[model samples]
Target: MPVKATREQRVGWHAAHKAACGCRDIPASLRPDVIKLLRSRRKP
Candidate 1:
């Protein structure tokens, strides 16, 4: 067996990515549109 990272590491990466993308001021009103755009551009 080996030492391993838990879900927090993965979750943290996404949080960091969002921060880097400057989503800090995303308004509640635009969340749905943002989500839709992200969903439309789903990863491979």
Candidate 2:
């Protein structure tokens, strides 16, 4: 991850990491936003 990643970048990296490696989860701070993003993408 970048040393000074933006909120979106941080969330995206964590999301991808969560998918590729089930070792860790996105931080609590970012979890809600990540879920919101995922839900939005699933919409028609």
lDDT by candidate, in order shown: 0.51, 0.80
- 1 in model 2: Cα distance from truth in Å? 1.1
Per-residue alpha-carbon lDDT of model 1 for 20-40, expressed as tens digits?
696465446555555555566
- lDDT over C-alpha atoms for residue 31 of model 1: 53
Q: Which ranges in model 2 have alpha carbons more than 4 Å from their true place? A: 39-44
The alpha-carbon lDDT assigned to residue 1 of candidate 2 equals 88
In terms of lDDT, the poorest run of 10 residues in model 1 is 1-10
Error of 1 at 37 (Å): 0.5
Q: After superposition, how far is residue 4 of candidate 1 from its true place, in Å?
A: 48
Minimal lDDT window, size 10, model 2: 34-43
Record all residue pairs in model 2 with backbone atoms less than 3 Å apart, i.e. clashing: none
In candidate 1, residue 39 scores what lDDT?
62
